[model samples]
Target: MALPEPGADRRTLDADRATAVPTMRSAAPLLKTSTAGALLAIAVMVAATVGAAIWLSIIDQRRQAQEQLTRQAHAAALQIRARLIETEQLLLLEGSGYAASADRFRRDMEELLDANPALLRVELRGRDGQSLVGVDAAAPRPTVAAATRTALSPEAAAAFDSAARMNRLTYSRPYYVTFGATGFDLMELVVPTGAVDGPMIVAVYAPQRILDHFLPSDQ
Candidate 1:
Protein backbone atom coordinates (compact mmCIF):
# COMPACT_ATOMS: atom_id res chain seq x y z
CA MET A 1 0.00 0.00 0.00
CA ALA A 2 2.82 2.49 0.80
CA LEU A 3 5.18 1.73 -2.25
CA PRO A 4 4.49 3.43 -5.63
CA GLU A 5 4.81 1.55 -9.01
CA PRO A 6 8.16 2.28 -10.72
CA GLY A 7 6.74 2.01 -14.29
CA ALA A 8 3.89 4.41 -13.42
CA ASP A 9 6.36 7.15 -12.24
CA ARG A 10 8.50 6.63 -15.37
CA ARG A 11 5.46 7.06 -17.64
CA THR A 12 4.37 10.30 -15.82
CA LEU A 13 7.88 11.82 -16.12
CA ASP A 14 8.03 10.92 -19.85
CA ALA A 15 4.67 12.70 -20.44
CA ASP A 16 5.88 15.90 -18.68
CA ARG A 17 9.09 15.94 -20.85
CA ALA A 18 7.14 15.52 -24.09
CA THR A 19 4.78 18.45 -23.23
CA ALA A 20 7.73 20.80 -22.30
CA VAL A 21 9.70 20.01 -25.51
CA PRO A 22 6.86 21.16 -27.87
CA THR A 23 6.33 24.35 -25.88
CA MET A 24 10.05 25.19 -26.23
CA ARG A 25 10.04 24.29 -29.94
CA SER A 26 6.98 26.53 -30.61
CA ALA A 27 8.73 29.64 -29.00
CA ALA A 28 12.07 29.10 -30.82
CA PRO A 29 10.89 30.31 -34.28
CA LEU A 30 9.49 33.57 -32.81
CA LEU A 31 12.80 34.22 -31.02
CA LYS A 32 14.72 33.53 -34.21
CA THR A 33 12.51 35.92 -36.22
CA SER A 34 12.94 38.74 -33.64
CA THR A 35 16.77 38.31 -33.71
CA ALA A 36 16.83 38.42 -37.53
CA GLY A 37 14.72 41.59 -37.55
CA ALA A 38 17.12 43.24 -35.05
CA LEU A 39 20.15 42.34 -37.18
CA LEU A 40 18.59 43.76 -40.37
CA ALA A 41 17.77 47.06 -38.61
CA ILE A 42 21.42 47.39 -37.42
CA ALA A 43 22.77 46.74 -40.93
CA VAL A 44 20.54 49.41 -42.47
CA MET A 45 21.57 51.98 -39.89
CA VAL A 46 25.29 51.35 -40.56
CA ALA A 47 24.85 51.69 -44.33
CA ALA A 48 22.93 54.96 -43.99
CA THR A 49 25.63 56.42 -41.72
CA VAL A 50 28.37 55.50 -44.21
CA GLY A 51 26.49 56.96 -47.16
CA ALA A 52 25.96 60.28 -45.37
CA ALA A 53 29.66 60.51 -44.46
CA ILE A 54 30.69 59.92 -48.07
CA TRP A 55 28.36 62.64 -49.38
CA LEU A 56 29.64 65.16 -46.83
CA SER A 57 33.24 64.35 -47.73
CA ILE A 58 32.59 64.99 -51.41
CA ILE A 59 31.06 68.39 -50.62
CA ASP A 60 34.04 69.37 -48.47
CA GLN A 61 36.51 68.45 -51.20
CA ARG A 62 34.65 70.53 -53.77
CA ARG A 63 34.64 73.56 -51.46
CA GLN A 64 38.37 73.27 -50.88
CA ALA A 65 39.08 73.04 -54.61
CA GLN A 66 36.98 76.14 -55.31
CA GLU A 67 38.78 78.09 -52.60
CA GLN A 68 42.18 77.17 -54.02
CA LEU A 69 41.18 78.31 -57.51
CA THR A 70 39.93 81.65 -56.15
CA ARG A 71 43.19 82.25 -54.28
CA GLN A 72 45.27 81.54 -57.40
CA ALA A 73 43.21 83.93 -59.53
CA HIS A 74 43.50 86.72 -56.97
CA ALA A 75 47.26 86.27 -56.64
CA ALA A 76 47.71 86.38 -60.42
CA ALA A 77 45.73 89.62 -60.67
CA LEU A 78 47.84 91.29 -57.98
CA GLN A 79 51.08 90.30 -59.70
CA ILE A 80 49.90 91.78 -63.00
CA ARG A 81 48.98 95.08 -61.31
CA ALA A 82 52.39 95.31 -59.65
CA ARG A 83 54.17 94.75 -62.95
CA LEU A 84 52.07 97.44 -64.59
CA ILE A 85 53.04 99.92 -61.88
CA GLU A 86 56.72 99.13 -62.39
CA THR A 87 56.38 99.68 -66.15
CA GLU A 88 54.66 103.00 -65.54
CA GLN A 89 57.53 104.23 -63.37
CA LEU A 90 60.09 103.25 -65.98
CA LEU A 91 58.15 105.04 -68.71
CA LEU A 92 57.94 108.24 -66.62
CA LEU A 93 61.70 108.31 -66.10
CA GLU A 94 62.28 107.79 -69.84
CA GLY A 95 59.80 110.52 -70.71
CA SER A 96 61.85 113.05 -68.75
CA GLY A 97 65.02 111.95 -70.51
CA TYR A 98 63.23 112.22 -73.86
CA ALA A 99 62.33 115.87 -73.20
CA ALA A 100 65.96 116.74 -72.37
CA SER A 101 67.91 115.32 -75.36
CA ALA A 102 67.28 113.01 -78.29
CA ASP A 103 70.62 111.23 -77.89
CA ARG A 104 70.04 110.75 -74.20
CA PHE A 105 66.59 109.30 -74.89
CA ARG A 106 68.04 106.82 -77.38
CA ARG A 107 70.71 105.80 -74.94
CA ASP A 108 68.13 105.32 -72.20
CA MET A 109 65.98 103.20 -74.50
CA GLU A 110 68.93 101.01 -75.40
CA GLU A 111 69.79 100.54 -71.77
CA LEU A 112 66.19 99.73 -70.89
CA LEU A 113 66.00 97.15 -73.65
CA ASP A 114 69.28 95.62 -72.50
CA ALA A 115 68.34 95.56 -68.82
CA ASN A 116 64.84 94.10 -69.28
CA PRO A 117 64.61 91.71 -72.17
CA ALA A 118 60.86 91.46 -71.50
CA LEU A 119 60.49 94.90 -73.10
CA LEU A 120 60.34 94.04 -76.82
CA ARG A 121 60.28 97.58 -78.12
CA VAL A 122 60.01 101.26 -77.21
CA GLU A 123 58.86 104.19 -79.33
CA LEU A 124 58.52 107.88 -78.65
CA ARG A 125 55.97 109.70 -80.80
CA GLY A 126 55.74 113.47 -81.25
CA ARG A 127 52.50 115.53 -81.36
CA ASP A 128 52.17 115.10 -85.11
CA GLY A 129 52.53 111.26 -84.95
CA GLN A 130 56.21 111.48 -85.94
CA SER A 131 58.52 108.86 -84.45
CA LEU A 132 61.05 110.63 -82.24
CA VAL A 133 63.19 107.81 -80.76
CA GLY A 134 62.71 104.11 -81.43
CA VAL A 135 64.36 100.84 -80.43
CA ASP A 136 64.02 97.45 -82.14
CA ALA A 137 63.05 99.04 -85.43
CA ALA A 138 62.81 95.63 -87.09
CA ALA A 139 59.95 94.59 -84.84
CA PRO A 140 56.39 95.25 -86.02
CA ARG A 141 55.29 98.66 -84.80
CA PRO A 142 52.08 99.13 -82.78
CA THR A 143 49.62 101.73 -84.08
CA VAL A 144 46.96 103.46 -81.97
CA ALA A 145 44.45 103.42 -84.82
CA ALA A 146 44.77 99.69 -85.23
CA ALA A 147 44.67 99.13 -81.48
CA THR A 148 41.44 101.14 -81.14
CA ARG A 149 39.76 99.47 -84.08
CA THR A 150 40.67 95.79 -83.78
CA ALA A 151 43.39 94.71 -81.34
CA LEU A 152 41.71 96.17 -78.27
CA SER A 153 38.09 95.98 -77.14
CA PRO A 154 35.87 99.02 -77.51
CA GLU A 155 35.84 99.67 -73.76
CA ALA A 156 39.61 99.37 -73.57
CA ALA A 157 40.06 101.71 -76.52
CA ALA A 158 37.77 104.28 -74.95
CA ALA A 159 39.72 104.10 -71.74
CA PHE A 160 43.00 104.47 -73.61
CA ASP A 161 41.75 107.53 -75.49
CA SER A 162 40.48 109.18 -72.30
CA ALA A 163 43.72 108.51 -70.46
CA ALA A 164 45.79 109.82 -73.38
CA ARG A 165 43.78 113.08 -73.61
CA MET A 166 44.28 113.65 -69.87
CA ASN A 167 48.00 112.97 -70.20
CA ARG A 168 47.87 109.95 -67.90
CA LEU A 169 49.69 106.63 -67.96
CA THR A 170 47.50 103.89 -69.43
CA TYR A 171 47.94 100.30 -70.60
CA SER A 172 46.23 98.54 -73.50
CA ARG A 173 44.70 95.07 -73.46
CA PRO A 174 46.87 92.04 -74.14
CA TYR A 175 47.57 91.37 -77.83
CA TYR A 176 49.47 88.58 -79.59
CA VAL A 177 52.86 89.37 -81.13
CA THR A 178 55.77 87.47 -82.65
CA PHE A 179 59.25 88.98 -82.52
CA GLY A 180 61.93 86.92 -84.27
CA ALA A 181 61.89 83.33 -83.01
CA THR A 182 59.89 84.13 -79.88
CA GLY A 183 56.16 84.74 -79.65
CA PHE A 184 53.99 85.81 -76.71
CA ASP A 185 51.12 88.01 -75.56
CA LEU A 186 52.14 91.65 -75.33
CA MET A 187 50.76 94.66 -73.48
CA GLU A 188 51.32 98.28 -74.46
CA LEU A 189 51.55 101.30 -72.21
CA VAL A 190 51.27 104.93 -73.25
CA VAL A 191 52.92 107.32 -70.77
CA PRO A 192 52.36 111.02 -71.15
CA THR A 193 55.15 113.63 -70.74
CA GLY A 194 52.81 116.12 -68.93
CA ALA A 195 52.69 118.13 -72.18
CA VAL A 196 49.45 117.42 -73.99
CA ASP A 197 50.93 118.36 -77.38
CA GLY A 198 54.42 117.00 -76.71
CA PRO A 199 55.98 113.60 -77.23
CA MET A 200 54.56 110.44 -75.56
CA ILE A 201 56.27 107.16 -74.75
CA VAL A 202 55.00 103.78 -76.02
CA ALA A 203 56.41 100.70 -74.30
CA VAL A 204 55.65 97.06 -75.16
CA TYR A 205 55.97 94.38 -72.47
CA ALA A 206 55.52 90.60 -72.29
CA PRO A 207 53.20 89.28 -69.56
CA GLN A 208 54.96 85.92 -69.53
CA ARG A 209 57.85 87.59 -67.73
CA ILE A 210 55.60 88.60 -64.87
CA LEU A 211 54.16 85.07 -64.63
CA ASP A 212 57.62 83.52 -64.69
CA HIS A 213 58.67 85.80 -61.86
CA PHE A 214 55.64 85.25 -59.61
CA LEU A 215 54.34 81.73 -60.34
CA PRO A 216 55.88 78.35 -59.66
CA SER A 217 57.67 76.63 -62.52
CA ASP A 218 55.30 73.65 -62.44
CA GLN A 219 52.32 75.94 -62.96
Candidate 2:
Protein backbone atom coordinates (compact mmCIF):
# COMPACT_ATOMS: atom_id res chain seq x y z
CA MET A 1 0.00 0.00 0.00
CA ALA A 2 1.18 3.56 -0.72
CA LEU A 3 1.96 5.64 2.43
CA PRO A 4 -0.64 8.46 3.08
CA GLU A 5 0.24 12.00 4.29
CA PRO A 6 0.62 12.59 8.09
CA GLY A 7 -2.03 15.42 7.92
CA ALA A 8 -4.50 13.02 6.24
CA ASP A 9 -3.92 10.44 8.95
CA ARG A 10 -4.50 13.09 11.64
CA ARG A 11 -7.70 14.23 9.94
CA THR A 12 -8.98 10.62 9.73
CA LEU A 13 -8.23 10.04 13.46
CA ASP A 14 -10.05 13.25 14.41
CA ALA A 15 -13.14 12.24 12.45
CA ASP A 16 -13.22 8.81 14.10
CA ARG A 17 -12.83 10.41 17.54
CA ALA A 18 -15.72 12.78 16.77
CA THR A 19 -18.00 9.85 15.79
CA ALA A 20 -17.06 7.85 18.98
CA VAL A 21 -17.93 10.78 21.26
CA PRO A 22 -21.51 10.97 19.95
CA THR A 23 -21.90 7.17 20.22
CA MET A 24 -20.77 7.25 23.87
CA ARG A 25 -23.11 10.23 24.53
CA SER A 26 -26.03 8.38 22.92
CA ALA A 27 -25.36 5.29 25.20
CA ALA A 28 -25.09 7.44 28.34
CA PRO A 29 -28.87 7.70 28.75
CA LEU A 30 -29.29 3.87 28.52
CA LEU A 31 -26.46 3.42 31.05
CA LYS A 32 -28.12 5.94 33.34
CA THR A 33 -31.52 4.27 32.84
CA SER A 34 -30.06 0.82 33.60
CA THR A 35 -28.35 2.19 36.73
CA ALA A 36 -31.61 3.84 37.89
CA GLY A 37 -33.57 0.65 37.23
CA ALA A 38 -31.04 -1.40 39.20
CA LEU A 39 -31.21 1.08 42.09
CA LEU A 40 -35.05 1.01 42.05
CA ALA A 41 -35.02 -2.79 42.03
CA ILE A 42 -32.64 -2.78 45.00
CA ALA A 43 -34.88 -0.31 46.88
CA VAL A 44 -37.98 -2.36 46.21
CA MET A 45 -36.25 -5.52 47.32
CA VAL A 46 -35.06 -3.84 50.52
CA ALA A 47 -38.57 -2.57 51.25
CA ALA A 48 -40.10 -6.00 50.66
CA THR A 49 -37.53 -7.64 52.88
CA VAL A 50 -38.09 -5.11 55.64
CA GLY A 51 -41.86 -5.48 55.41
CA ALA A 52 -41.58 -9.26 55.57
CA ALA A 53 -39.31 -8.98 58.57
CA ILE A 54 -41.81 -6.70 60.34
CA TRP A 55 -44.71 -8.99 59.54
CA LEU A 56 -42.82 -12.02 60.75
CA SER A 57 -41.83 -10.19 63.88
CA ILE A 58 -45.49 -9.32 64.58
CA ILE A 59 -46.57 -12.90 64.02
CA ASP A 60 -43.82 -14.17 66.25
CA GLN A 61 -44.81 -11.72 68.96
CA ARG A 62 -48.41 -12.82 68.78
CA ARG A 63 -47.39 -16.45 68.96
CA GLN A 64 -45.29 -15.75 72.00
CA ALA A 65 -48.15 -13.92 73.67
CA GLN A 66 -50.51 -16.80 73.05
CA GLU A 67 -47.95 -19.25 74.39
CA GLN A 68 -47.53 -17.19 77.50
CA LEU A 69 -51.28 -17.05 78.04
CA THR A 70 -51.50 -20.81 77.56
CA ARG A 71 -48.75 -21.35 80.09
CA GLN A 72 -50.50 -19.10 82.59
CA ALA A 73 -53.78 -20.95 82.10
CA HIS A 74 -52.13 -24.34 82.49
CA ALA A 75 -50.32 -23.22 85.57
CA ALA A 76 -53.50 -21.81 87.04
CA ALA A 77 -55.40 -25.01 86.34
CA LEU A 78 -52.70 -27.09 88.01
CA GLN A 79 -52.74 -24.91 91.08
CA ILE A 80 -56.51 -25.10 91.30
CA ARG A 81 -56.42 -28.90 90.92
CA ALA A 82 -53.87 -29.19 93.67
CA ARG A 83 -55.88 -26.94 95.94
CA LEU A 84 -59.01 -28.95 95.32
CA ILE A 85 -57.18 -32.16 96.13
CA GLU A 86 -55.97 -30.70 99.37
CA THR A 87 -59.45 -29.56 100.24
CA GLU A 88 -60.78 -33.03 99.50
CA GLN A 89 -58.28 -34.53 101.87
CA LEU A 90 -59.24 -32.07 104.56
CA LEU A 91 -62.93 -32.80 104.08
CA LEU A 92 -62.37 -36.55 104.24
CA LEU A 93 -60.47 -36.18 107.49
CA GLU A 94 -63.16 -33.97 109.02
CA GLY A 95 -66.06 -36.10 107.77
CA SER A 96 -64.61 -39.12 109.52
CA GLY A 97 -64.74 -37.18 112.79
CA TYR A 98 -68.47 -36.40 112.39
CA ALA A 99 -69.47 -39.78 113.83
CA ALA A 100 -67.31 -39.20 116.90
CA SER A 101 -68.62 -35.83 118.09
CA ALA A 102 -70.79 -33.14 116.56
CA ASP A 103 -68.89 -30.51 118.56
CA ARG A 104 -65.54 -31.84 117.38
CA PHE A 105 -66.73 -31.96 113.78
CA ARG A 106 -67.87 -28.32 113.93
CA ARG A 107 -64.58 -27.31 115.50
CA ASP A 108 -62.60 -29.10 112.80
CA MET A 109 -64.62 -27.49 110.04
CA GLU A 110 -64.09 -24.09 111.60
CA GLU A 111 -60.38 -24.69 111.74
CA LEU A 112 -60.36 -25.73 108.10
CA LEU A 113 -62.22 -22.58 107.15
CA ASP A 114 -59.72 -20.52 109.09
CA ALA A 115 -56.79 -22.25 107.43
CA ASN A 116 -58.19 -21.81 103.92
CA PRO A 117 -59.71 -18.39 103.51
CA ALA A 118 -60.71 -19.30 99.97
CA LEU A 119 -63.08 -21.99 101.18
CA LEU A 120 -66.50 -20.46 100.90
CA ARG A 121 -68.43 -23.36 102.36
CA VAL A 122 -68.02 -26.94 103.51
CA GLU A 123 -70.90 -29.37 103.74
CA LEU A 124 -71.37 -32.95 104.79
CA ARG A 125 -74.32 -34.35 102.99
CA GLY A 126 -76.22 -37.58 103.58
CA ARG A 127 -76.87 -40.18 100.91
CA ASP A 128 -80.23 -38.56 100.31
CA GLY A 129 -78.40 -35.37 99.24
CA GLN A 130 -79.46 -33.61 102.45
CA SER A 131 -76.83 -31.47 104.04
CA LEU A 132 -76.25 -32.99 107.51
CA VAL A 133 -73.68 -30.54 108.74
CA GLY A 134 -72.63 -27.39 106.86
CA VAL A 135 -70.34 -24.51 107.66
CA ASP A 136 -70.51 -21.36 105.62
CA ALA A 137 -67.62 -18.94 105.75
CA ALA A 138 -70.11 -16.13 105.92
CA ALA A 139 -71.87 -17.76 108.87
CA PRO A 140 -69.01 -19.77 110.47
CA ARG A 141 -71.66 -21.44 112.58
CA PRO A 142 -73.10 -24.84 111.71
CA THR A 143 -76.39 -24.48 109.86
CA VAL A 144 -79.06 -26.87 108.60
CA ALA A 145 -80.48 -24.33 106.12
CA ALA A 146 -78.40 -25.81 103.29
CA ALA A 147 -79.93 -29.23 104.06
CA THR A 148 -83.41 -28.16 102.97
CA ARG A 149 -82.01 -26.24 99.99
CA THR A 150 -81.97 -28.03 96.67
CA ALA A 151 -79.07 -28.22 94.25
CA LEU A 152 -77.37 -24.89 93.50
CA SER A 153 -77.98 -25.69 89.82
CA PRO A 154 -78.48 -28.64 87.53
CA GLU A 155 -74.73 -28.78 86.97
CA ALA A 156 -74.10 -28.77 90.70
CA ALA A 157 -76.59 -31.58 91.15
CA ALA A 158 -74.93 -33.57 88.42
CA ALA A 159 -71.51 -33.11 89.96
CA PHE A 160 -72.81 -34.29 93.32
CA ASP A 161 -74.55 -37.29 91.77
CA SER A 162 -71.47 -38.15 89.72
CA ALA A 163 -69.22 -38.07 92.76
CA ALA A 164 -71.61 -40.25 94.76
CA ARG A 165 -72.07 -42.74 91.93
CA MET A 166 -68.43 -42.88 90.89
CA ASN A 167 -67.29 -42.81 94.53
CA ARG A 168 -64.53 -40.48 93.42
CA LEU A 169 -63.68 -36.82 93.67
CA THR A 170 -65.58 -34.62 91.22
CA TYR A 171 -65.69 -30.89 90.56
CA SER A 172 -68.53 -28.67 89.45
CA ARG A 173 -68.19 -26.11 86.72
CA PRO A 174 -67.47 -22.54 87.72
CA TYR A 175 -70.54 -20.72 88.99
CA TYR A 176 -71.07 -17.25 90.33
CA VAL A 177 -71.80 -16.85 94.03
CA THR A 178 -71.75 -13.95 96.43
CA PHE A 179 -69.13 -14.05 99.14
CA GLY A 180 -69.30 -11.27 101.74
CA ALA A 181 -69.97 -8.21 99.57
CA THR A 182 -68.14 -9.33 96.44
CA GLY A 183 -69.41 -11.76 93.85
CA PHE A 184 -67.10 -14.01 91.87
CA ASP A 185 -67.10 -17.37 90.17
CA LEU A 186 -66.34 -20.40 92.30
CA MET A 187 -66.30 -24.17 91.86
CA GLU A 188 -67.39 -26.97 94.13
CA LEU A 189 -65.37 -30.12 94.75
CA VAL A 190 -67.21 -33.29 95.84
CA VAL A 191 -65.61 -36.15 97.67
CA PRO A 192 -67.76 -39.21 98.19
CA THR A 193 -67.50 -41.07 101.48
CA GLY A 194 -67.45 -44.29 99.39
CA ALA A 195 -70.35 -45.58 101.51
CA VAL A 196 -73.20 -45.96 99.05
CA ASP A 197 -75.50 -45.34 102.02
CA GLY A 198 -73.37 -42.71 103.75
CA PRO A 199 -72.67 -38.99 103.36
CA MET A 200 -70.41 -37.08 100.99
CA ILE A 201 -68.12 -34.11 101.58
CA VAL A 202 -68.58 -31.02 99.43
CA ALA A 203 -66.43 -27.91 99.52
CA VAL A 204 -66.78 -24.66 97.62
CA TYR A 205 -63.62 -22.85 96.62
CA ALA A 206 -62.69 -19.52 95.02
CA PRO A 207 -60.92 -19.95 91.69
CA GLN A 208 -59.32 -16.57 92.07
CA ARG A 209 -57.23 -18.00 94.89
CA ILE A 210 -55.53 -20.37 92.48
CA LEU A 211 -54.95 -17.63 89.92
CA ASP A 212 -53.49 -15.44 92.61
CA HIS A 213 -51.09 -18.21 93.47
CA PHE A 214 -49.93 -18.86 89.91
CA LEU A 215 -50.04 -15.35 88.37
CA PRO A 216 -48.82 -11.91 89.24
CA SER A 217 -51.11 -9.38 90.84
CA ASP A 218 -50.96 -7.09 87.81
CA GLN A 219 -51.81 -9.92 85.47
Which number leads on TM-score?
2
Candidate 2 residue 52 C-alpha distance from true site, Å: 3.1
Question: Compared with the true structure, what per-residue lDDT tens digits does model 2 show for residues 106-147?
Answer: 777778777775676777777667777777765542222464
**Native-structure RMSD, model 1:** 6.2
Which regions of candidate 2 are displaced past 4 Å? 1-6, 110-118, 138-155, 158-187, 192-198, 205-219
RMSD (CA, Å), each prediction? 6.2, 4.9
Clashing residue pairs in candidate 2 are: none
Checking candidate 1 for backbone clashes, the offending pairs are: none
lDDT of 2 at 61: 90
State the displacement of the C-alpha of residue 25, model 2, in Å, after optimal TM-score superposition. Answer: 1.4
Give lDDT for model 1: 0.68
What TM-score should be assigned to candidate 2? 0.68
